[model samples]
Target: MNLWRRLSGRSRALALTSAGVLVAGGLVTLPVTAAQAATQCSVDYVTNDWPGGFTANLTIKNLGDPLSSWTLGFTFPNSGQKVVNGWSAIWSQSGQNVTAKNESYNGSLASGASTSIGFNGSWTSSNPKPTQFTLNGTVCNGGTPPTTAPPTTAPPTTAPPTTAPPTTAPPTSPPPGQKVDNPYAGAKGYVNPEWKAKAEGEPGGSRVSNNPTAVWLDRIAAINGTPNSSSNGSMGLRDHLDAALAQGAGYIQIVIYNLPGRDCAALASNGELGPNDLNRYKAEYIDPIAAIQGDAKYRNLRIINIIEIDSLPNLVTNTSGQAGGTAMCDTVKANGAYVNGVGYALAKLGALGNVYNYVDAAHHGWIGWDTNLVPTIQIIKQAATASGSTVRNVHGFIVNTANYSALTEPYIKITDQVNGQTVRQSKWIDWNQYVDELTFAQAFRQQAISNGFDSGIGMLIDTSRNGWGGTARPTGPGATTSVDTYVNGGRIDRRIHAGNWCNQSGAGLGERPRANPATGIDAYVWVKPPGESDGSSKEIPNNEGKGFDRMCDPTYTGNGRNGNSMSGALPNAPISGAWFSAQFQELMRNAYPPLS
Candidate 1:
């Protein structure tokens, strides 16, 4: 079947924390395609040793739907494997001959697919050999008799597969209590100061620059504190991660909050993991983060792992009941290891090692959802801390306040109240609204750092509706600005992922949006892209065409559905005039030379 048709029955995937707009307590169930036939699949994992005196393990699973949840586990072999560095999944080992275990997944896999998992372990001797393997229950190579006969005479093969794809070197998992720099570092881009003025010139534009503050940039280099590069897209080499990195950005007070995914809320409506999404995160989100960290490109990139807490633990059911079932408080105890198993998987793959985790502080209005914000944070924090990370290494947690509407007076007032009373630093980024991207960004940075943080705060936007490139119309009433003015400002801190890159895609590279040249914003990020369509195909049916309406079609309005349809489609549509991508690009390129 074709991609869309194949995905027809699939539900949209949810992030660990993607939630309803500003609601904290209620579960987030993102919209998705009607259910398709469930694919059939199974997995088997094995543990082995390497010549480097370390323990190793492997997982082989039939891709009944190209599953991405394959992870191998191994005992420490006497704690021999110290787990100095790793990735692909969270892991841990005990004993002198350290053994490792398989990690978990949160995305997708198609049918009739198979993937393997392996890790390096260290031993006191020149080389140590592992002697165990487990697949859910059945055993594979290490010595245990296979439950079933193999095609070959050998009961189990101890040797590495000759066709084994080159192992992706894992990143160093920081010792329990150290704070590593964020992944986005030295993101080479020019920050224009005259962005706001230029925005007004766009169709149905407002004086965005004149309002509060705006930040912009074009061609932001994805710096991971390592040598790895950003994932490529239809627009050539564009950095999706730069938006997240922009959050805790500044020369002296550098801090980083590694929040993955483009349209997490849109992704999470499904409330359960799909094979395709599970694999996507492994290959796209989590793995890429690990690779960058492993490469050590931006050593200064402080690592702060964020788990979006949109849906309840039990949104999806499994043999044990619904996955993540039970409240955060109850589940952690019952499934702490499994939860830790999840964390461990994340940790083993470079999650818990040095990176401290922060969960969604609140969903709607800082505690609006069914899941209690403060209480859930307490549970997740306790569970995460139980992993044995250091207090200093663990940074305080936070969440997006309001419905990406921090620019509104209500969000500002509430945030002002929280910061005034609490000594603890709390950060909430505004979804670039109003004309105050800089204002909120600067405030968040100060609060985060003052609370003993090493860096400032972040300001992320929801630009999928606008399609990042200058071609789309302004969905909101705020004015636009140049790239320069937006990036550098008195109160501005950093810019996290503003648009939904790849996911909830907008215009392609040729038609991508550009920041106003005069503003000189920090980075003109491709928050949205071509390949990954928005969760709800309602907006633009084929994921093609031009104009902001086509790019941000959450409401299927492009097909003529109006009113509430437009509610999800565009907040400020029926734009004054048609979108002119060429004009926008010309203005932006002149200011941001990399684009020029």
Candidate 2:
């Protein structure tokens, strides 16, 4: 994982006002008082839609008189379109009509002021944009009210739909050499020649050597290629891009990992910059990479950038006053470097039309709990909005990077019950909502949209090391004796605990990278190149800025994260990012869909 870690170094809306408008035999007055009438308003309705659902973001500008509050109104062209969940406003739908009332924090709409709000919605027959809108009771965009008023009955208050809508084909891919909805679709993934060579050197490695793996630009040196570096060899950013073009590859995946005070929660992957070195991160690391990526020579290639891994999540789970909190995480959080650095990277790289930025979201074991999930989403939102980056700059998100979370737990589910108890009550689940990477990624995407991300955002799951295959893989559900017995027996992930993230024994290569494998998943990516060490099993000195994390040691017991259990890491592993032949051999042997 260190090679992957440092490859170089390795690593809502609207206001409404209304003038008095008469329609449908009723006044249908504006929500504002007579003194304040929003005579002019504009509703910027934008949506990212798939087959049966979509995410709609609406920006309402009060172009007329100021108002104390506003109520934005619209009608779904297709009656089937419905708001499932929303944020930054009080969203309610009645028949074909939708209304969003400003929340307490954004109720004030001075003339010319604007606010944004959005929702995750579902559509059955067809999804079409609402052509007309109303602020308060006044028609927006200078249009007159419809002859028929929308249903006035209050919408029934209910929880968001828990089940996903029916899967429909995603919209058509964009034209060639342009940004497509799924970069992996109809694209040849850039296979890192260096990694391919290493795999070819291994016993029976040629079988999967050609599969694509990400090129890690883990440090400043990694940008130009780290000569004499232990793992990466001398291939830098341009070298890889040139190779991809030579290979006629359609897309290349690059991990933009170095952040000021990176990986604050763990010692194993600590980065080169200090907590306050954000300016240096911008000028030195990000600016140079952005310059190279913006090169017209690579314009035809879809460059996927996996933004900083393990940074933002620490702000939620590992900051002081939280469970599993760390002093390093607290410092990083207080300095506001991680959020700002990620935002800056996103803005800089994302400005290039060819670059698709996927920010790293930690695995389910770390932030799947209710206590951790929402806050993590909020922090990510904060970062996405910081440093001049908007949600549009973010192409999507990636999960399970450089980790071993199973892609899917077929035998065990959160709803499974044994005897009289549910799986959530089991030791393995620990009341977490998700049991696998796919569920967490999909759920997180929807939650992100509800929190105001672009609705079209897709999710990528790194399946490099999650395949818990071979004979150890569970064949079916466990016996019905007890919850723990059921979950533990049938689980595919053979780690001592979900918190065991270092180089673990029995881990294997997961599904081969593929595009649109699941509903909302853009691709199954090998972001964390397999065979790379997660961290040293013992303290072996190195200048990579990495440290000895006890969790990587097979003999070390766990921390609060793993419930104080034994570390499940394999013995005698090398330091983070260095290649390990034993780990590669194990991965091939245990590959879920077993290597051919």
Candidate 3:
């Protein structure tokens, strides 16, 4: 996703007469009729040149009626302009000329609509200013016509400085290969039906591969993948579960991070449960979750409810208040969702039979950044354990390292606590590692050994949207950095090994679990579901085309497609839907492995 700026070297000359003359190598004239004069637009220029010359950016705002298209003209400042290149649009300039023309690839801009064009240029000196500027025969920035005074040209004696030609950027890193970091590498396709039946027949059934079986697992879980939320009110939930059950999913993790009234850290509306009205949050979310887990086909899919702790203010309020004890007390009096005591409420959640409550041991928790340390983990664990409900499989909680080094730091402390302390599963779920996946399998295996955990330890990936952008780990528990760690650095990290399908648009098979006994990672689970909108788009371009859209769209890249909709067109254009299903199957193959 690197944006490259290309520049072309050329100069523009304008001659004022009854007919406007634009001279590049050949003479092109525009008749100065009312139509041409009225259609004129203005260009405002800003240049970003550092130790090197600047890249001129022109904001072309049309002053005339909406036209099918536009052709702009601008003279480089100090004759120091070049048409390197542009994108999302195109640019062309006469040889050695800075004057350029642009055309929209898709459609025309409406009246008053603006478009931006930029070109790379090398200035003779630092921070050079333009001697003159114009757009479409009209002087830019309301400047007087160039005809009134001839443009000042560069001195004839000044010779051009010779510099090394620019080099092309390093090619993008290839999509991760199989055996990337796990033994379960590159297995694609859905669960085998025979295995699924055997798994279902087993008492309590299990998604864990047993007896060299391939049929007992869903392709989605194997790939650490998700299905697109259809237009159905259930949004393909029924079909999704069917697909999942086909894979012999004995345990499934569902997240209700966006329900209304989720007052984690006492942040108001931080929970996206969609309003506390009538406690409908529970009815709408909790009930459905219970049904999924309780279903006979998926009864084996133990339900682990992964909940986001707080919204912005809830996180901020809790952190700030806790940081300032008295301040927190006062804030709580006014707006504490846990006014009744978080410890008690957490205990109640632990008591829920069908729901294995998992809390985030992150930023606002004991091992959070700028908040508390592992002490908070100790506190929450104490409270949840003390709740005294022997809810079966009240399994362990997971930490959201968000893949950033800072967030990942706490795993060491938890690991230390678990290894050092006489902790019980009922008390704190035995620090069995709830943090997200790593960028490579080696790191994952290393942590497993170093942390004294085995393959049974719960290692979940919060690939809420796609896998960690190949290898770029998040900077904090929630901050994303775009530096592709895989490309910039050699080898993938544990997060990638854990199956964080963070990037769905990039071409490749979905991530498969590596079968390295050295890295004792247990289940590679998808903490993030597909089809769930990531809530960023348009105003947030990078955030757009995420979720199922990225993986399902075929035009984006890759040779395969997901599947076609009723319209007979690809569901999400550019990215392939076929790729998604294929990758999903690949992940399932890795996670559920054909037990031979």
Evaluated with lDDT, which candidate comes out highest?
2
Mark the 10 consecutive residues where model 2 has the least summed lDDT.
Answer: 2-11
lDDT of 2 at 482: 87
Q: CA lDDT of 147 in candidate 1?
A: 37
lDDT of each residue in 1-596, candidate 1, tens digit only: 00000000111111111111111122433222112112123333222222332212233444233544443443443443466444445555544433334354423334444343434344454432333333333322222222343243434658877796868864432222223232223422222222233445554334122222212111122222212311112211113234324533321111111222211223212222232233433344444444433222232333333343332222221123322123432332444332332243234333222333333232222232223323443444444434332223233333331122122221122232231342112222232222233233334334434543334222232221221233342223221132222222211111122222112222212212233211112222232221122233233222111113332444333221111222232222222112333434332432211222
Supply the global lDDT for candidate 2: 0.80
Residue-level lDDT of model 3, residues 41-72, one tens digit each, is 55554443333443444556665556575555
Distance from true position, residue 125, model 2, in Å? 38
Model 1 TM-score (2 dp): 0.35
- Tens digits of per-residue lDDT for model 2 on 1-596? 00001000000112232333432212345443322332577766544455565556566777777889999888887879898755567789999999988776568998888775666577899876665577887667432223444456866899999999879954432322445688888899999998988899999999889999998887789988988777655799999999999999999999898998889878888888888898778767876676567554576798999999988999998877866889888888888899898888876666555678999999999899988888898999899888867677788999999999999999987887777688999888899999999999999998988998888889999999999999999999887788888898899999989998998899999999999999899999999888888888988888888889999988998888789999998888887777888999999999988887
Error of 3 at 334 (Å): 7.0
* Model 1 stretches with alpha carbons more than 4 Å out: 1-95, 98-292, 297-306, 309-342, 345-358, 362-371, 382-398, 401-403, 408-568, 571-596
Write the number of the candidate with greater TM-score, choosing between 1 and 3. 1
lDDT of each: 0.29, 0.80, 0.33
Which regions of candidate 2 deviate over 4 angstroms? 1-176
Error of 1 at 43 (Å): 29
